[model samples]
Every structure is written in C-alpha cells, then in structure tokens.
Target chain A: MSTRSPTPVFLDTLRHVETPEGIELSLRVAGPVARVLAWSMDSLIRYGALWVLLMVLAMLGEGGMGLWLIALFLTEWFYPALFEVYAGGATPGKKALGLKVIHANGTPVDWPGALIRNLLRAVDFLPLLYGFGLVAMLCNRNFQRLGDLAAGTMVIYRDPAAAMPQLPPGRALPPPFPLNTAEQQLLIDFAERSTTLNPERQAELADLLARQTGLYGVAGVERLCAHARWLAGEPT
Target chain B: MPLETIAAELRRRNAWEATDLGMVMVRQWLGSIYAAWFTVALPLFMLLHLVCWGHWWLAPWLMWWLKPLLDRPPLYILSYALFGDPPDRRQFWRALPGLLLRRQAFAALTWRRLDVARSFTLPVTQLEGLAGKVRRQRLRDLSYPSRGAAIWLTVVGLHLEIALDFALIALVWMLTPDFIALEFFDLLDDSSQWGQLWLNVVGFCGLSLVEPFYVAAGFTLYLNRRAWLEAWDLELGFRKMAARLAPAGRVAAGLAMLALGLGLLMIPLENFAAEAPSRSNPPPPAIEESLMNPLCEQRRVREVELAQAGSSIKQALAETLKEPELHVCQVQERWRWRDDNSTESPPRSPPDPRPGQWFAATIELLLWLAVGLFIAVAGWWLWRRTPRAFTRARQRAAQSGPRLVQGRNEITIPPDAGLGDTAWRLWTEGQPREALRLLYQGSLAGLAAQHGLPVRSSATEDDCLRLAVAQLANPELLGFLRRLTRAWQAIAYAHRIPDEADARSLCLEWPRHFAAAGALPA
Candidate 1:
C-alpha cells in the first residue's frame, strides 16, 4: 500500500480556485515587476493627461495663470472626486495605473473609501514628497501607502496572453512497433537533443535516433516506431 | 458530441473580454463632463467674487451668464454617449451596480488604492495593524486594481477637454468681429473682406474643436456599447437578487444605503440651491483674479523671483526627505533580553514605555543609539513585539517549499517510486509541471484510460495497454511503451496491476522522454 502526499492535491485545488468565496476574481499570481510597471504606466498617463490639459489652458490665458490655478485645484480634489463618482478612480491616472477603489469584500469602492484615500494623500505625501509613501510601500506586503491603508484598496496587474515552445529534431532509435507519419515525425523531432545531451553530440545522436525512430531507417526503427504508436494513445 | 460543442466549451473556458478601450472611453467622457462643468463654474465663481467685492456692475457686462451654458454642449454629448439615444436617468442609476461589479474595472480600482497608500508616514505598528485588517479579507473590496486605471482615464479625458476648452476660448476671442476688427479690421477697411477672413478663421477653428469632440464622443459610445454587450447588467442583477434573498440584515443595510444616497442627492439641491440668494451675497474670494494678477505691481519681479526660490527650496526638502534613510531601518540587535550570549537570539519584547511620553523620547533614543546596552535591550524587545516582523515570518513560513536548483535546463526525477506516485511526488516537488508537459505530449495508460473508461477498481496494466492500443483513436503512447508491451500483456491478462517499484520507475522516466511521444510532421 502507498500513501499519497496531499501537496499535489492542494496545488490542484488552488489552480481550480479561480474565485474564492464571495469574491468575484480568479486567483492568479503575477510577477511583481509586471504589476508595478502596469501601475506606474497607468498613473503617468492619467496625471500626464491632466498636466497636459493644464499646460494648454495656461498657454491660452494671461501667462497661463488660469490653467495653473485649475491644475492646482485639480491635483488636490478634482482628480479623485471625478474618478470616484463616475469611473471610480482618482482620475484617469489612477485608473490607468490598473488600480481601482473597492469595498473590503471585493465590491465596488464606496464614497467613503474614495474620500479617505484621496484625503490621506496628504499624509502619504509625508516629510518631503511621496517619500513616506515609498517607505510605506517598501515596508508593507501589498505596497500600500497611508491613503491606501485608510481607504482599504489595493493595486494589482491584469493577465497577459500565452504561447508554447516548439520541439526540436531527434536521433535514430530502433522502432518498437508500427508508426504513422505524424507519430514518426513527432518522435524524430522531439528526441533529437535531450537536455542531457551535449550540444556537439546532439546532431550525431539525433541523426542516429531519427534513423531508428522511422524517420529514415531499416526494420523501420522498430523501437522508435513502437513508442510513437503507443504515445499516440494520449491526447495531443 | 459534435466538434462545435467541444470548440464552444474550449472557447468559453479560455475567453475573457477585452475591456481596455471601453474603460478608457468611459473615463474620458466622465472627465470631459466634469472639466466642462468646472469651467462653467469658474466665471460664475468670478462673478460672485466681484459681487461681494462690490464690483456688481461688471458682472452683467462681462457675460458671466454665458459661462454656465458654455459647458452644455459637451455635457450633452457626453451624456448621450454614455447613456445612448433617449438616455434614461433611471436606467443609468440601475446600471451603476453593474458598472461597479465589473471585474476589469474593479481590478483597476484596487491598483489605485495601493498607489494611494504609499504616501503616509504611518508608524510601522499602525501600518501593520491596518494590513492585518486588510489581509483578513475585511478590506478586499475596497482595494481594487482598476480604480487606478479608471481614475487615470478620467484624468486624461479632463486634460483633453481642458485643451479643447482653451482652444475654444482662444478661437472665440480670435473670431469675434470686434476683436478681429480691433486687431486687423483697421488694416483692411472693406467690410466684405473682413467678413470673409473672419468666416475662414472661424471655420478652421470650428473644425479643430469639432474633431476632438466627435472623437471623444465616439470613443465613449464605443466603450459604453462594449460594456453593455458584456452582460454586466445581468451579472449585477443576479448579485442584487442574491443580496435580496440573503439574510434580513443585509437586506436592511442595502435599503438603508439606497435611502442615504437619495437623501444625499436631495440635501445639496434643497439646502444650497433653494437658498441661492443668501449664499450669493457672501461669495468666496476672487481666487482666479488674484492668482492671475501680480500683487503690488511695483515689486512684482522681485516677488516672483523670491517665490520661485522658495518653491525650489520646498522641492529640494521634499525630495531629500523621500530618501530611504528616513524610513527603512535594518533590524540587527542582540541583547541580554533573550537568553544572553545565545548564538541565535530569541525574539525581543517591546519596552513598556510610559503612556504618551514614549513617542518623542523613544524616537530620539532609537535614532541616537549605536549598540549601546539600553538601546540593544529595547530594540530586541521591540523586534519581538513588532507585528511587521511576525507577519513577515509567517508569510515566509507559508511559502516554504523544496529548494530546487536554480538556472538548470534539466530537471532531475527522484528515483525509486511507482509511476503514479512519482508523478504526484514530482508535482509536489515542483516537477509536476514537467510531468504535465510529458502528459501533454502523450501518455499510454492515460489516453487508454480516457477512452476505455475502465472500472476505477480493476485497472490492470494489461487492461490499460489493450485500451491504449485498441480503443484510442491515437495510440502514440501505447506504441512508445510497446517495448514493455509483452510484459504488460501478462499483467493485464493475469488481472494484476504492477506494484509500486515498476510504476514508480516508469513515472520517473516518463517526463524525461515524454516530449518525443506526440510529434507530428507539419
């Protein structure tokens, strides 16, 4: 009798757990650098948009005073308020940052959370600039600033697309059984250079296996043929 | 089942609607409407300021009334784009829930919250306390990633609109017959020539303004349509239904929130707008006017220089304080507090400082201390009690796993195990992924097992092998294992599954050779 370790079972369970109870998201872990870059880009775009607008407006008025005045007001209140109420972000900056305002249980961000986070932007600002905020992020696990702590919100990255690797050619091996063209090709191609094989040795071995595996062989690489035919039993 | 059924299922399993463009558009329109509204309010505010300053005569002549209406066209366009033809306020309100629950949108919100949280000088203790609350799932909803994205989108929209508005005003000034006449009409006194020139300039400016607006409106409409098609409304309706059917307390809370929202909406209209006259009398200061003007004109240049210098100093100070030395501190204190002279010191216990007095005193003492006895003892104590440290340790422990050799091209399979056991073990040891790769290529018993639907209890090696060869549409794996077919034939016919060692060896060797099992010529 053999006892099974529950580790695989747990991991399998975790994989299938797209969403936890009461939450609406599939639980997928992402790389930290990717998450940070996505967020930074989002913020830059949003704040940059506002800044550009202000610059244009300023260019229009007497020495751009009107634009500057509006920009100042916007940096403080307008950015967050408009996003929170309509798009549920501080501004396009926050939104682009791949961040959202939500309730504690993964619901839409309420007005209080929005207000608290925006208001605490002053505290997160700290001794000089967002230095305090940076420190907070460094110290905290989720990289939350003071405003985020107050607001109870977080920043996370979204999913990207997927791709697969192609197989290499193989060496000649004796065929063990009958084989189809596709199966023969698959075996010949894949077993060409096992990771264990040295680069210099790979081509020589692959040619040998290919001949035996039915790619170019006599007795038609019986072992290779047999393996290819048996392997066909599994899904592609 | 037909291939269509399989394809449909696969598509559904893999599908996720792209929401980026839609989110971007909605945020842009929201920003536009808000910015336009703000613009309209500016002149009104200015007029109100002048009225309080007893410059009431200037208000009417300055065309303050037109300020509010200036934003109308943009607002109308935005409203139409967001809500569609024959826009309904009720439907808009109803759709709010759906919009709120959107997955991508919600992800953006969480990102926004994390960005916001980084700004404060929150003591490590307090921050940890908050983090505890957050990680406990108490604060999950409040921290969505998409909040940041949506906000930034709005910011962009606002900027675009502001630029448009500025261009509008500049165009307006440039096109006015009076201004044109003042600047150029004198140069060419012919009325028809002046009119024609003015018409051409106006036409050009009109085209510029109309293009951005149309683009913006179209973008917003596209996003709204996409959002609608995603069935966000249905999702929200289901959630609402679930909440309604839940316990009475949740139902009551939901109702209360609705009532509160309704009341809040009414408060501003009822209180402020109704008493407009009283409010109008005591207007806010002339912020824009003063901001635009140089106070005490004689010293304007000197003042500007001084202000610029001051701002630079402020910026420098802000930047300096943001440096890491101010916040990040390493923990390396060993004191007699936890088993004196012990190589691995036990966790420290925090000092019981006198209430309300420790803040300034401890900060200074801690900053000044350098391996001093008192500080060491205190630091060790503090480290022990620090929730941050505890949380870090806990997390580290949770993530502990078998150490795999890093940067290796080849994975080593464990020896001495049955095939199934080996696969399971490899998976636990971070090699299951490699095994899965093998499985993807082709596995003899696995394919046969899938096809034959063998009895769970009676899966002899022979039975598995026969199924692999006879039942499977494809038998690459069985062919690969044909070297052992003679041996397996006896086991299957004899009604006996291979014992632990044979199975284990097969499992171990399988992944190393699995890739070659399913290759096909292009």
Candidate 2:
C-alpha cells in the first residue's frame, strides 16, 4: 500500500520544476551556499595577491614617478591579460570569487572573452572607480560586463567536483540507453557526486527522473523517479 | 526508469564525487593565476619600461624575481643579454619607477646614446601565426578550457583602437603651422624630473583634448564593422523599402536596435564626460628668439607680463638685466637710480599655483572616468533591458509569490475561468484535473488581471506585488507573493534561488488562494 498520494497543499506549487524552452534546459539552482562562500574566498586571495605585487613593484621602483605611471597602465592592461592567457581567469579577485570565464556554450575562455572583460574594466572603473562595472555586474545574468556580452562568455562559478564518474555499478536494470562509455561514465559520475548538487538541482533532477530512466513519453515519470531513488539507495 | 529518475540519480552521484581535492586545488591554482597576474604585471611593466629606457641598475633585480613568475623560457635569455648580471638590491632601488619609468629618463639616455640597446622582448606574432596556433589548440582548450586567442585579439584591438585615435590626432596636429615649429624632440631629450613630469602631463592632456574626434572616428569604424558583419545595413534598407511600400511595423524593430546602440554609445558622452585626452609626446619649446612668428612673440609678451607680475622692483630689475635689453652691469647708473632699500615683502606670496594645477588635472581625470563609466553602465542597461524571446520560469515563480514550496509540479485551473491557451485548452477538454495541474504554474499577470489590479507586461514584480497587497485584504497571499518574488529574482537574474519551504507552499496554494482572494478582496 503506497502512502504517497497527490494532495493540494500550499507547498505543491513550489516543487522543483523544469520548463521546456527550445534546446538547453535552464536550471534554477538553490541551496549550495558553500560554492558562493568558496568563490568569495578565492576572489579575495587572488585580489590580495595582485595588490601585493603592485605594492612590491611600487616599492621596488622606489618612488620613480615613471615606474609608478607604468604601474598604473599595467594595473589596467597587462594584469588582466596575464590572467586571461595564463590562468584563464579574471584578476585573482574574480577567480577567487568562484567565477570562471567561459564561452556562451560553457567552453573555456577565449581571447575575446578575456580581452573584452579586461578592456571593459576601463568602463567598469568609469565615473571614478568601478561604479559602472559594479552596476553592470549587478544587472546582468552571470554578472557580465559589456565585454562579456560582446565576447559571448560568462563569469561562472564552476565546481570541479561536479564532474560525474563512470557508470554506477551493481544495479540490475534495462539496457536500451544508447549511451557510449564516456556518456555512461559521465552520467554515473554525475550520480555518485550528486550530493554536491544544490537543492535546486536536486529538485530539477527529481523532476526529470522520468526522462533519465527512459520513462519520458512513457506511462509514468513520477513513479520512475520514486523507483530510481529507491534503486540509488535514497529514501523514497 | 523515468528521465527524471536518471537525472536525479546522476545528480545524487555527482554530489558524492564533489569532494575531490584535486579539483579544489585546480580552482585554487586558477585563483593563484589571477593573483599572480595582478601582482606580477605592474612590477614587470615598471621593469620593462625602465629597462627599455636603459635603467640598468634596477633591471637585474627585477629580472631575478620576474623570471620565476613568468612561464616563458626566452625571458631569461633576454634578461641575461640585457643586464649582463642579474639585478641586486642596490640596482633595484636605483631602478625604481621614479627613476626608471619616466620618458625623461628614456629621453635623457637616448640623447646620450649610452644605454643598452632596446629590443621588443614580448614577441610580436603575425595574425596568421597567432590564429594558426589558436586553431590547433582549440581542441585542447575545449578539453581543459582556458582563456585562449580571443582575449589576445581583444587586447590588440584595444591598443589598436587607442593607437589609431592617437595617430589620427597626431596627423591633424602635425599639419598646423604653429605645431610644426614646436621642438617636441628636444623636450623628449630633457630627462629632468620636472621636464619629464611636464611632458607626461602634456601627453595626457593631448590624449584628453583629442578625445572627441577619436570617439567619433572610433564609433564610426565600430558601426561600419558591425554593419558589414551583420548585414544590418541591408536589413535596414529592406525594412525601409518595405515600410515605404506598405508603411507597417516591418521597419521598427531594426531601427530600434540601431537607435539603441547609438543611444548606448552616446550615453557616455552625454551623461558623463565633456572632454578626455589623447596621449602624445610634446614638442620642445622653440629656441629661436625671432619675433617673426606671431605665436612666439605672443609667448614672449606673455612671459614679460608674467615676469613683471611675479616680481618686486629688485627682482624685476634682475629679470630685466637677464633680458637682452636693459644691461644693469653695463649701465650701473640706471640700477643706482632705483630705490634699492624699499623692501616691501614680495607681493603676498600669491597662493602657490600648484594646487590649482593639480585640481585641473584631477578634474580632467574625473571626466575620463565619468565617460568610461557611462559607456559601461549604459551598455549594460541596454543589454539587460532588451527582452529575450523565452521567458525564464523562475521569473514567473518570482512574480507569483515568495516562498515556493516543493510538491506541486503541475498547473491548475479555476472552474469559472474558461479562457486558456492551446496547451491548457487540450488539458482542460481531455484531462480537467491535468489542466488544473498545468494551471499551478500561474502567470502573475493572469492572477493580477483576474483580480483587477492594473497589471501589464511592462510591470515589474514589485509593481504587481505592491498593487496586489494593497488591494487584497489577505496578508497570507501578500506574504506568499513576496517570497515568490525573491525566488523569481534570484532565479531569473542571478540564476539561483533560495531553497525555502515557502516556495513550495506558495506554488501549491496559489490556485485556490488566488481564486478565493480575487473573489473576496478589499
């Protein structure tokens, strides 16, 4: 006898859901505050390093007015360039903030993204200091600047831990999945590491349980979700 | 298993694997890279400028430290060739920015021809060379994903853009008769502190002064490139032709985008800056004393006036004696006739003019800052304000209410309201309960409109919420809506949301509560 039954409740509307747009599924992630905290710490470290370097050079140049002038130029220009090229990040500040610059399709940062974002720092620093940049970041999705939009890249917090493992072992199941080894590995890896998935992701996955279990366009996706959760050793 | 099950399983397993320290280390390393970039470049830049200007003392010290920071192998060879020995502490202090980075230092050394030969240390790659490498590395980049070619090109573009603007101004300024006589090269040679500072200031001023012209040209070039790439001109032309033929909305959208871009570009100029500078080396002052040149004579007259204004009788006389006219040594009688004992304290030392000069420079810098900010802000505003074709679901949720509760995954329909879209129509006719489930994802606009709160497509969630709360007597609905808005904003704009029970509760209760509240409102 199944105790779970559909009933009207205030909480019902708040269930994790996926709305089908054309191609890519938009995720509404909730509750992974650790990522945010980590990002902030990372950004601080990076910025701190940058600030240290500047001070050292300033000290080295020993109040040479010319060297100081060059420092100003370097602060605005080559600083970003080095990160863009070598580290594939913004200045240590942006990177430590858990933000990685990526192309629109979630690819590695290209030169355009790096240059645009960095060059746009001039704009961000407009009207005195970082006023425009802050405003732009506040307004845009992924906290992008004009350079980001133009370059088709985003500054996103990436979880290296988010990379999934090879297929989950020891579960007897149906076989017509049409997945290659890499794909299998990717999915399995994703499942094993699922605890790191923010609550919003968990909900989204729960909602999509039907499709992953090959129950999409079939009789019952919700039931499949409950079944899969049980199979995966989660309480259902 | 259902698709949802697979997704959930994958997500669960992924969470378990997120504990990899390696990934964390990579992140930290990437962060370090950012730090290194910020920290290393300024010092490196100072070193580069100093070295180029032949500040050999500091070169060795900078090289010793810089080699470790960089990835390049050739830098060591180059540093060795330039410095003969690595820099020591003594050389480091001697070569600091104050001494090394100045153009005056460069000029002074260049005049003497005693400094080490300068070479471009950062290699200059051809477009083909750069692009070929980028293409080859594309796959690798995708696998590891780092900042690659696009960033370099953009940097080059920035330099080119600024360079082109400067070049144009220089071209224009060079054509003037007065500028032709200006001894720019001599000024460059004078390596004194004041001389170098003055020259740099002048260069900065020049950059600012020619900003308007550069902006116009740069903007035109940018637009032309955009047009060529997007065929926007053709689109506009076609729209114009169509509009002329029938006079409809066919032309409005494209025109709007063009106007929008123009508006964004122009906003910086309009809202922020009046003037900014173009940088260039200043020509040295003329040596020739000939009064034939009007500009030179004007300067001479101005100098005489300033000398008179700045001096007392004795000082005036001293200055006059220095001039070719009025020889005080030869004509001692003229000097003797002057009241030498009348010591009135030199005209109450006119407030040192340095502060005023500094103030003007600050204002100029501020203007540049303003313009830059306006461009960035306006551009961002435009980018975000324009509507995308697809609506984010989170946005809808935010608009509905605060505190979305989990459980309800379907839309619901009110029995009285028959109007529905196609999907709703099908669900209502075939599966009334399913239709009700579908209706769970209520449009905030629909809810507002049904309740008669002057809601429109243009209204923001705050706007709707305010009106709804004010009009409705139920605090429960208001609270729910408020929580929903928070989630919606977080989800739509931030791409994240807070996980609270209220979100699920609001989603579940919205249909019945909204319907009942609308029926019995304040």
Candidate 3:
C-alpha cells in the first residue's frame, strides 16, 4: 500500500477510493466551471420560486408578507441541505448537471454533514459573490470550497457505467502467444474504441503488435480484434 | 514534442475538465508562471500608468484591451512547462517580444479584441503559429465543440475580476476604523488622481491573479481538443507497445536469418555430395531428391495441414455461433390497461377536495398545537427556576470562608505548628497514613492561601495535581507536589505504606515546595 511513486504515474481528475469492501471506486471530481453553472441554476430556481411565492403572498397583505419572509429564510439556508440529504445527494441543479455531493470517504452525506456545509455557505460567501470560496476551490486539489472542506464533502461528476462497445462481426480466435491481463485489456479497449479511429489508424495501431500476432496491416487488426473477442469470453 | 515527457496525463476530456487541468497546470507552475506574468505585466502596467499621467482611467482600459498581448508570456512559459521544460527568467525575457508582437497581434487588439473565446483561440496563433485562413480554419475546428465552455470561462473570468475588484475595495472599507468614517460611495465615485490610481492598482492585481489561470485553462482545452481529434492517447499506447516488442522482434529476425544462412550452407554441401559421388555406391534416387530440395516437401505438407486446420476451425466457430445462449432474447411481461376501451368506461373527473382539505387542515392545526405546547412548556420551566435563581446568589455569598477538605477528611492544622515537622513526627509514631494526609491537606491550603491557586475544598488528589500543573511555574515545586500526592494516595487508598527513606524524603521536600511559598514563617 505504501509503494507510491515519487511522481504521479498518471494525471487525471479521477480520484480512486478504496472501500472496506475491497473495491476501488473511481470518482471524477467536478471542476469549478460546472459547479458554478450548477450553482447559478440552483440560485435561479430558488429565487424564481421565491419571487412567484411573493407575488401570490402580496395579494394576502401582511400575513402573506410574513409567510414569504419565512419561505425566503428556508430557501436561502436549508434548501440545498434538504435536497442534498434526501435527493440522492443532488439538488435539482446538480441532478441536471449529473453532479452529486458525497462525503470525502465516498459515503452518502448524513444530516449533520449536509447542515454544516450549507450553513458554512455564509462564510464561503464572504466579501461578495463567493470570492473567498472560489479562491479556496481553485487552491484545493479536490476543488472543494470552504464549506465543503469544513463539512468533509466533495462534489463529483456522476458518470454512469459505460456500456461495452459492439465488436465487428468476426470469428473469435485466440492469440498466437499468451497475453497478460493488461495486454488483453488493451486489446479489448482497442476493439472498443476502434470505431472512433480511422481505418488507417487502426491498422497502424495493430501493426505495433504485428510481431506478436504474426501478421501485419489490415490482417493484423483483424487478428487483434479476434483475440479481443476471445478474451471477452465470446465462444470460440 | 515527445508525448511521454508531457507533464500532464493526457486523455479524452470534456472542455470543463480540460479547463480544470489548466487550473492544475497553473498550480503546478504557479511560481514560474506568475514570475513570467509579473516580469512583463508589472512593467507594462507601470509604463502605461506613467504615460497616461492625468488620464488614469484610460490606462486600465488600454491594459485590459492589451490582454491578448499580456496573456502570451504565461502561455509561453506554460507551453514549454507542459512538456516539463519550464523556461528560466532569461528565456522568458527573450521570448517576451516575439510572444507579444507576433501572431496577428494587431488583429487581436482590434477587431478580435471582443472575442469571448480569446484565451481558447489565442494558442492557435501563438503556439501553433497558424495564421490567416489556416488559423481561422484550425480555430473553427477546435472551438466547434468547446466554444460554449470557453465563452463561459471568459464570462466567469470577467465576473471574478469585477468581484475581486469590489471585494478589495470592500475589504479596505471594512478595515477602516469607525472614527475615520470613510464613505463607501465616495471611494467608488472619487475622481481624484489617487482614487483613479488606486482603482488601477486593484484592477492590475486582479488581472495578475486570474489571467494566468485563464490562459492555462484555454491552453489545456486546446490541448485536450487536439488529443481527442488526433487520438494521441492511442498513439502513445501504440508507441509504448512498439518499444516493448522491439527487442524481441529483433532477436527473432536475427534467429530466422541465421537459420536461413545455415540451410543455404547445407544445400551446397548436399549438392556437392550428390555431384561428386564420394560414397562407395551411388546414393538412392530418393535420398538424392531429398538432398536436392530438403525443405520443399516438408513445407508443402505443413501448409496443406494448416489449411485443413483453418477450415475446420472456421466450421466450429460458425457452429458455436448458432448456440441458444449466444442469441438470447429476453421476454418481459408487464400488465397494462388496454389502449382501446371505447371511451375508457367513463371520463376522468377532478379529484374530490374535501378529504385532502381536511387532512391538510388537520396537519396545520397539529403544527400550531405543537408550537404552542413548546412555548407553554418553556414558560413553566422558567417559572419554576425563578425563585431558586434568586436564592443561589445568597447561598454563594454565605459560603465565602476558606476550608481545607482532603478526600472525605478535614484536617485542622494548628496556626503556629510547622506542617512538615508535625507530619514527620506523625510518621515516626507509626501513623504514616495520617502523616501523608496532613502533608496533602497542608499543600492544598498553602497553594490556595500563599500562591493564590484557586483550590476547591472538594478537589480530589487528581484535581489538585491538575490545578498545580496549570498554576505552578516552578518545576521543582510541581515535582515535589506530584511525589507527595502519589505517596498519600498509595497509603490512603491502596493501603501501601511508603519506605522509611521515601517517607523521610517527602517530609524534607514538603517545606521546599509548599513552605518556600511562605506556608510556614520561621
């Protein structure tokens, strides 16, 4: 577990969390742009709802004004907390953007965590327009704002599991030589992403493994795809 | 540039993630990027302000308009930095002019000044050196997918700049003392030279912080788009695979060449034997033919066998594909109402409101009742505590006299007797527990009376030790107190008596710790 390289092996936004269940979950932390957009959308919804309520409440005079004030207080403070806790860790805006708030340990946020983060929004909004919060987010590796840092929560992009690519119709054939798991996965990924590459590029890529496959050019590509199919457990 | 040396891990990323990568890039190279930025920007800002002496407002606008020019140095630094070769101060200065003046600088500051995706497209001209129609076509292709994010980046950048500017002003206003009475509105509307100069300084500060991030984000977005369009990750993977196999491929080729060379050498030797007829008798016709073309017959047989195997394998594959598991079609059964029921029996009517209204009214009434009950309970509790609160002050006043209580025992020390001398006498008389108790009680009383430690009468040995730790400045005194308390607790609770030497040491050390604080006046 301590065999970390001095420099990172690869750089990407994907954060890997290992659960006690012995599974590694890869989460992509959403950056500031998407978060800001989602926040603006939430603000629009919150205030837009409040404005409509105010209009209806104004017709009822003083009592309506008091009720509108209470609605304003709730929307300003508890709106995000309630939605985040109950709505599978997403507010309506976050859901629209396919983002969710979760604990730093990759668990669903509980009531206290949700309330603490939302309450600290007042501090994150210091000076004006979340200026301090933006700076904090930019500085943090996880892109967590001050509220998020305090509450031990983070916003991650909720990516669904990608479906397997449909392989081209071909007879499954085992590779001439044995392949390790990484090499086998590479072959499978090549078949998966080959549709996006040009035929010449595909042939070029396959030509790299030509020595192993005992083939070259288009024939090499077909052989690798066949190997990929076999590795994927297609009946051979 | 070699892909392996690129600092950032490149993959297919959306525009926002690419921008985030740029943010990470800026963080990684923050010191160098800022040094590059301020090295040119600060001088340019001062020069512009100096030139526009009285018209200070024009300088900031000019500086803002020259952002494309200002943005190049950091971009230049980052472009090299991305490939892990960050330019030094010398290289940065040397590259500054080319970056500022080259690549359609005139168009950027003029018609293209308002380009919302300026940072995103800036790299097309500056880094790639594309220009004219070629530059336009490249940018159109790159920006096609990411233009919206790039525009939003600019929009967010603009807002951030304004927000920071006002935040700085607000911070200054807030830090001002109340007696000074500085007006916020006056600060904004001030037309004086100092005010205008202050605004310029704040604006420049904001740009200095945000411009590097803006440039880096755009650069990464451009990089991301290229990586996606060209499939650079796959190319890198292929390069890696080729490198890994290069040695094996060379060895196999060498071995094959050696085998062919040996076979060629054998061919002549065999033919010579057939020609010379060196054997006692002429070789058989079969042997002669086999020697003449040693590999031809074996190769033909192997090829024919392989062709047969290939056809059989194909036949098996085709047969396997016909299996039921390979062509599974799931049939899902779900109950649904018939689509055509003539008029759906009867037209749907509005829901009855009476039950729903009554339920809602009941909920509202329950909520009101809960609130009222809470208030009533709080009032009764306060009413019950009012009389006790008034008498508690009198009780506190009545209990002001000093009293020394050790554990559950009260020790009344004679006013004139030396506490250490009396405890020593008690120890010698076979009353170790009582002697230890007297030492403990006297130490607490001394701490409270002489050293002004607020030792409570009910404080246990642990509590006394804690208070002494907090209040005592002398280590020797604190150490003495710790030893005395431990000896006392051993005899009092654990019923373990101390050794004679230990008992004598405590009696001697007690005065040094407690009596030195004027616990006993000689």
Candidate that scores best on lDDT: 3
Q: Residues B255-288, candidate 1, lDDT per residue (tens digit)?
A: 6565465444334433333333332232224222
Docking class of 2: incorrect
lDDT of 1 by residue, A93-129 (tens): 4444344444434446667777787788777654333
Q: Write the per-residue lDDT of candidate 2 for residues B252-318, one digit (tens) a residue.
A: 5455554455445334433222332112322224424322443433333334443546558534533
Give the runs in model 3 whose Cα sits over 4 Å from its true position: A1-10, A177-182, A214-216, B245-522
Evaluate candidate 3 and give its CAPRI docking class based on DockQ. Answer: incorrect
The weakest ten consecutive residues by lDDT in model 3 chain B span B326-335
Best by TM-score: 3
lDDT of 1 at B196: 36
Residue A2 error, candidate 3, Å: 32
Give per-model CA RMSD.
47.4, 46.1, 26.8
Model 1 Cα displacement at B323 (Å)?
64
Higher-DockQ candidate of 2 and 3: 3
In the range A1-236, model 3's lDDT, one tens digit per residue, is 11112463335677789999999998778878778888889999999999999999999999999999999999999999999999999999999878899998899988988999999998888776787888898899899999999999999988766887678779898765545466677788788778777889888888877767778989988888998899888889
Q: In candidate 2, what are the lDDT values of residues A17-68, reduced to their tens digit?
A: 2334434432221111122233345546556766676777766666654666
Query: Model 1: how far is B380 from its true place, Å?
Result: 58
